[model samples]
Target: MHCYFHLVHTHERILDETGIEVSDLEAAHYQALKAIQELKQEGEVDDVDWHGWQLEVVDEAGRVLLSIPLDAAQH
Candidate 1:
């Protein structure tokens, strides 16, 4: 299945879009977290105040199904 993972941040109105192919919801969830981890590792999530950020998992129709809450990527 194809899903869109939206990284929504506290101080930003624009969403960071990541498209992925997954088998099911479980896989989608994993992919979302993995993306977040990669972004953090690359220092991509540092410049924002992301204390209340979220990994929003949306279906093909753009319906949000699950949201993985996030903390600040760096201290």
Candidate 2:
């Protein structure tokens, strides 16, 4: 399955052009976890909530399947 990972930040919104590939819906959760980690690294901060950021995982049809909030990722 192909999923779109869009970054919904407090100041900006980023749309992912190339989606990610996963075996199934369950695998998409793992990918979302990894993507959040990368985002944290890019921000040079372990806690992304300071900037009020979140990752929205959407299906091919544009339906949001899940939202990974930076604050939640800290836990």
Candidate 3:
């Protein structure tokens, strides 16, 4: 399955044009977490704020599969 990870905050969002291929939803979830971790690390180094951001995993039809809070990467 292909999943697009969109960075969103309320009505604002940065859409993912090219998505990644995964075996299943579980793999997609893992990828989202990994992405969040990388984003958080970059944010720290670049002094960017991502307090209310979320990573939305969606399918080809634009149906959300998972919604992960950016701050969850802290754990």
Candidate 4:
């Protein structure tokens, strides 16, 4: 089985305070993960986050296939 890792951080206090729908978050997370996997297979530099979420896709061998830093535009 393949697994994907995500690190999410929000500087906006409102976001932290707001209640997030678990099902929606889960669906979006997996969808983004799947897109990253496809990008990895396509030989594209997978470093993109649609929202405020960082993603890291690693293979079973513990090799990082993709690493995208979210909130990059903020810098």
Best by TM-score: 3
Residue-wise lDDT of candidate 1 within 1-75, one digit each (tens)? 888888676665445465778999999888887888887887777765577878888888889877876674344
Model 3 TM-score is 0.85
lDDT of 4 by residue, 20-74 (tens): 2323434545655565566556654344443665555444454545555544422
Per-model clash counts, in order, read 0, 0, 0, 0
Q: Candidates' TM-scores? A: 0.75, 0.76, 0.85, 0.32
Stretches off by above 4 angstroms in model 2 are 46-51
Return whichever of 1 and 3 wins on lDDT.
Answer: 3
Better model by TM-score: candidate 1 vs candidate 4: 1
Q: Could you tell me the lDDT of residue 19 within candidate 1?
A: 75
How many Å off is the CA of 59 in candidate 3?
0.4
Quick one: ranking by TM-score, best first? 3, 2, 1, 4
Better candidate by TM-score, 2 or 4:
2
Kindly report which residue stretches of model 1 are placed more than 4 angstroms away from their true locations once superposed.
9-13, 16-18, 72-75
Q: Which segments of model 3 are wrong by more than 4 Å? A: 44-46
Instruction: Name the weakest run of 10 consecutive residues (lDDT summed) in model 3.
Output: 42-51
Candidate 3, residue 39: the lDDT equals 67
